[model samples]
Target: MLLPRPLLTLAALVAALAAPSVMAIPGAVVTTPQVRAELVAHAPEGLGPGRPMALGLLIRHQPGWHTYWKNPGDSGLPTTFAWTLPEGASAGDIRWPTPRRLPVGPLMNFGYDGTLLLPVPLTVAEGFKGERLDVTLHAEWLVCKEVCIPESGDFALSLPREQATAGQAEAFAAAEAAKPVPATGAQARARIDGQAVVVEVKGLPADWQGAALDVLPATAGALRNAAVPQASWSGAVWTARLEIDPQHTESPPALDLVLVRDGVPAGLEINAPVSGSWPAPADAATPAEPAATPAAPPADTSLGLALALAFGGGLLLNLMPCVFPVLSLKVLGFAAHAHDRAKLLAGGLAYTAGVVVSFVALAGLLLALRAGGEQLGWGFQLQQPGVVAALAALFTLIGLNLAGVFEFGSVLPSSWAAARARHPLVDSLLTGVLAVAVASPCTAPFMGASLGVAVTLPAPQALTIFAALGLGMAAPYLLASAWPRLAGALPRPGVWMAHFKVLMAFPMFATVVWLVWVLGQQAGIDGAAALLALLVALAFAAWAFGSRSLGVRARTGFGLLSLALFGATLAWALPAWREAPPAATAAAAETGWQPWSAERVAQALAEGKPVFVDFTAAWCVTCQVNKRTTLAREEVLAEFRARGVVLLRADWTRRDAAITAELARLGRSGVPVYALYAPGGGAPRVLSEILSPAEVRAMLAELPAVAAPA
Candidate 1:
């Protein structure tokens, strides 16, 4: 059979070309901005009917970022997997590894950094007779460092019907070793001891008895993640006292506890029976460790208390600058209907209905989004540039209407005008809607606490609280309308009323100005300028359509020209609205404050400097007021300089998940949140929603003096 080398090679090449095509792969890889994901599979034995296989989603994170675990502590979402398997195949849940404690600002969370593998066991039906196993995986995870980003990937893998030991054996082994095992020799139990849950385990291995152990609640929402528990060994039994999470209202029949010891690769898992029931909602403990976690208003706050607070907050919102403009418009409506009792009563009821219904709708949407793992809160709509732009345009039109630049009835088609006149209360209803839209950005005094609690409660209870807020807001007008004497005291509708209506238009213009500024903060100067141009074009269109002096043909031509101009401007401006704003150099320079990040704060603290963080948004009137009156004061700035304090502003004008998480950690869902972190590793002192110069001075005084270079 011996032959020349060239002849042999030619024969081999011809044979290879004649071979059948076969597609076999160990797995697939997919990449995103923050993670590299791989769908890897391994079968020690040959793939056959009813044979079990190990499949895993291997996630390799970029440096400084991490994804959440199955039970993401405090404020994060766990990774999820959706599989597409061959017919008659099934998969088990992911075998999660022991997660590390991640400290975010003042909060503690449990997650994996670097690389992690979520392994799942899969099995095919015994009757299967396929030549190969085809599978697909859809994976989603929230990756976070300074900010959180939701990322996902899809992958497919085809495995031939043979022994597939060729895949990542070492990776699979490591993941298997990382999974927690049952504590075979140990018996554990838990009981409520005042504000803490006391967990005790007996018959642990002698070597593990005296070692320092890291405890994690396998059951989510059972124990406070941020609260550090006290652990000790009493004789042969290990005991730990953990703070109970307020959300955990009922006593669990069994507690899934995970215990990790240093120098160990895997943890010990225990299903411990609970002895005592959780305390009543009103008796839940308020967090005492200011350094560990900001005192969160209890999530289990009584329904009546939460409702009352929401109502009070809504009533107080009427005084906030954000709601003042819309209330003024309502005033104009009140004066016009002062003489008609029946009409006033109907209008008030309609307005109340609008506000309540709108609030419930909004609450439902927020809850749904949150359940789907969105990091959002109250006033979330203003975070969208499109919403802000739309609001600005809407306000501009309202202002024009009030200023007599256009009459609704005269400008609209005859049928439309007739319908509006016949149902005049519709205007009142819409005005109520407008009031809520404007008022959303402002978190009134009691409102902050109530809303913070509402977001954590059940949907029905949360919606009820929101409804109470709406009713309170509509109460003032409701009262005035019901009491005919108050309306009787008003001057009759005349030239003076017209003058007042025109004057009230100024506030609407002011609101438009604010919205444009807020848009600038989110989308920068270019976007704001484009919006102004669009607004000018729109105003022109409105005027052309409303002009009575021009002949029909002339008016029609002018209107068409204006409409074309507006359409052109809108096309150019929309892209600008989506564009990210430039770096906030000007604001930082003006205020002598830097932008906030967890690393920056840690670095400042490491260098023995106090850090003050201002969690705020441009649309929040309360935040703007505090910025002007307290944060911008010369004395406060001088104090900051004197103490070597680092100032950081977390602008929440746009949607930022990191800031949202931080606010959640601070027991707040919306901002104007101020926290002053002193050097030397102590808890930060959180300031009130409304800050005063004296309070700022006093808080600044708490900073320890830094010694001069020795």
Candidate 2:
């Protein structure tokens, strides 16, 4: 095809003017090296009846210039698509992919820089009239590199009415796959912390371990989008501190964030719900007080009955695995002076005092933290990686000392060691401390109600109950010493005592292993590894410091050097452990046990399914005991299945505010709070702390049967 010579110069003149433009029917296509704007039809199988069809709003931008997300941070306008679809067809929401943060001066913008497909689901109503569907899209966008320029164009596409072959569907499928799927385990909370708005999100995807949560509000002006978000992790929860836009007159109805896990380009994107306490802005003219926290549930049993339960629970605790390791220390104390009654009396008194003092201290701290806005309960200390690390080290040292790895050489002054050798009182006191610390995580039978009541009671009454618990715990050992016949029944203190102590050290070592695992759960594998390294360093320090062969001055020098190394290790480790991005929490997919959330619980209740919630913590020995013995057993699970029960494991291993709030609602404040929701909306049946498989089965079997969810 050759142009006439006369017209060729005319075309040349047109080319010289500027780049030529391409045109289409009922629409226009604008293309340049910097951007390409087009409307593409994604109807592979035409439109399904009463289903949504895909339509891609394709825009390709240059490296520097980019289009904006829904809430285009600051100083830019989002690309808009106004569509006129054929009769019986309408557009749904635009599904946006994860956004990038673009900076221009002091402003932060969220958008895409390269190719982006703003996909919309076009809902086609049933009984449509048209054979071929025609759509006209009027598009407008402000693309910016530094200076901003607004662009607009019209696009038209004809969608076929019938399903086509595979290639016709591939583009839409690819586009859909690239978008974020709905997020699971969704929870969010907002509050004012100083000048910033702090929003915390819990339970995204377990697979999104170490993922970054970048949130863009659905509302245009709810946030100062240009302000950078300061993110931090609290266990598996992600929190962002953002600068609130003072100019925005209203807060967002809800925090709807386009959650994007960093580096994950698959189905990890989601629009999820945020449910928790969202406090009003802190700078209100008349400051509003925070909502009052719910008190612990009222005591169902009489005070005398609760005390009896406490005593019985305390007695049974001696048999719990949590207390078994600690009892070894008491056994050592009992053996140290089996034949001498006066020293034994002094030892018992000191041990009892230690137990009572520890309980009082722990109760005070729990109350203080609760009052100070910390969502915490028993075993809360173990939830801290630092605390877990320290406890692990302590246990390891004790185990090593028992194993005769070293003596209390230069580390303890010679005079102090000499004094300890005579008294045996310090050993007894420490033994009691160990007992209570270990016991904190165990909610033996009657302990639950007593402790539950103690939390809500007046301070003095709570303290009295705690004191009673301490005395109960100390009773077995105290009674044995006070009654000479029980003490005398002990084997004669001799060579066997050495062997027994070494055997007991293994339990201490085992406890260390468990604590280290808990650290991994609280922090991450890296944190656990760091702690293990610290323990190794501590062992080396102890081995060097306890060297009797090294003289006092040399030992002292080695000790000081080791101490410096220890300090450095802690200083380097703790912050990193605290600051590292949280890994995905474990879910029991094999058993169909979902992570606990108030939303899930409410949903299950609304669905008319009987829900069983086990409020547990990783550090709670009693909770673990229940899990192994009853909750996870096949018999109990079958019963649950038969009864249409939804088993929800509310792990309070970390400080979860939702779980805490739920616990408060249940009138309890700790793990091992088992509640079974009625089929519909009804009061939940709070079960006993100590549950047997038979008991669980019996309880479920007793409920009036109903059809389970399909």
Candidate 3:
């Protein structure tokens, strides 16, 4: 029978006043001054013989330390309890109270800071209530602060069999009420715009601050503690742009968000939605869309302008360092066919068709992957080792071919060189394919905005944008092919053509070298060595094929050997794809240069230190040029140092998931992202992709005086 409220309250008061001593069970104390256990309770209050009673496992931690909850945020371990009860008795799960968020330098951990009461409910057997109830439990918990220590203990509780009064039940109920509650209506929706992971959360209270918010992963190895998440508040919504851990595997499981508002515990369980939709559909197309915006005149105008810009950007790409080599070759082909207008027109049209077809295929693949719930970005192709290795090999072979080391099929075997000179169409079509391939590495201006929109738009619209880009890229080549007079106006092919071709080979070789370097960054030194070996083998095979004395069999043998080498390399390199290491740039001491980390940047800004972050990639020629011509110069470094500027280098050489996410956080998807944190509290000053020395100096000069000496 349930006891009266007044009587239950009186019993609870007596128990509190008694302040019973906590005795350690046999083998319970693993370390000195700390007792660990599975169960603990007042002696006489235990269940009767053969009956189990509710028991509390009091984990009294060492001073300045504590244990953990099931979801250990940032750091710490959960306290596990294994029970061994007397015959006819059963034990219930432990009830855990809300934990406090512990900040250890750059990392955030969830754990108890002091003593904790873990109460476990026990079931008393029918007709077993008699004399005494004995229960045993084994428990383990991890305690930490800067460093971590794991501890374990065995504990037992004995209680008398009696009709438990209402007083005891009320006391236990109050303790249970203190347990931490999980956050409800917790949803994590993410949008991949450019290179950022803009994660939005709903059902959160207004004025949500970082201190009260903690992001926990529901699955193991989902989010890294080292990765910093920047939080912002807009009314009832809270958004956190977390640097997706590059080390984090793709398509991570659902994330658990623990929200503590003014110490009131709430929980949010969020899985990466299959697609970005409200009441997210199981078969949603993309992860999520950007927040809705009204259809304004500016929005339409901006999109039209973006399309125009994409066309212009595609045209400009033809002149880029990487694309120029193929363009020159195409020009040579056009010059040779200038006298034949029909052939010229056919060649141009064919080349344009190739460009459009390739672009359409790429767009289709990207969309298909998105439909299958994959997160992809503009330069996602470069993330694949096989792709990188193949491109490297192709460039090397092209270099050798252009240097007259080998020849393709020709009608006149006796005068193969003359035959090659006669057919400009072959070179023209190949050049078109080559241009698109090379242009993949360099993201031109206006391309990011367009591509970002394309990836999120319907398939047809996306393909149209892609086709427009292809048309722009093929425009110059098509013009030369369609108009013989224009082609004839150019210089005739001669020895200079050979020299130019040879010159172009160096650029191709340069591209190969850059790719190899990126491979090293992605797969580590061992992977890079393997790629290098593959390249050497390919070069040897080409040389063998070019040899005049080599028979068809011998040439085929060498070709097979090269293919085998590449296959072996791929076997080793593919699985080892990883983020590239941070860039190693020499900076003046005064600049207080440090490796780029989101936490460090936050701390620096909090401490009132101005920061300048250089987001660059080794494979980006523009980035390299900016580094050499501006940022790395002694004058610039010294000036930065003298002013106590904090220098942060965010390297995106290979496929860095974290840096990519960080870039996305800043509303960018590519490299050469520069942002300056100024003193006196203002938004960071964002610099353009192309930075001149004067531009860097001027930005520095405009900053306030250094608060601390370098």
Candidate RMSDs in Å, in order, are: 9.8, 22.4, 17.6
List lDDT for all candidates, in order.
0.79, 0.69, 0.61
Give the Å error, residue 417, model 2: 2.9
Query: Highest lDDT, which number?
Result: 1
- TM-scores of all candidate predictions against the true structure: 0.66, 0.57, 0.57
In TM-score terms, candidate 2 sits at 0.57
Better of 1 and 2 by TM-score: 1
| Model 3, TM vs. native | 0.57
Tens-digit per-residue lDDT, 145-249, candidate 2: 633445667677666566431332555665676666666666777766544567777786677655666666656655666666888777888888876664443
The prediction achieving the highest TM-score against the true structure is: 1
lDDT minimum window of 10 residues, candidate 2? 283-292
lDDT of 1: 0.79
Predicted candidate 3 versus true structure: per-residue lDDT over 1-710, tens digit per residue = 11122333687667644543433334433443343333445323445444334677666566776667775644456888888867777777777665665655445556675556777766766667445555667776766542344455655544445534222354356556666454456456776433335677766433443444655544433344445567777766678765443233344433444444455443444554423322211221111111111112243555576567667777877767767766666766676666777878988987888777777777788679757845445556766767778889888887887776775441126576665667655656666776776675565343755665665567887777778888888888787777767877877667787787777677778878888986775666777887887788777767766755678888789878867876665555554443222233333232455656544555566566678888776566677788878887898888887677888877565444445545554445566678786544444566777788888888888866555546
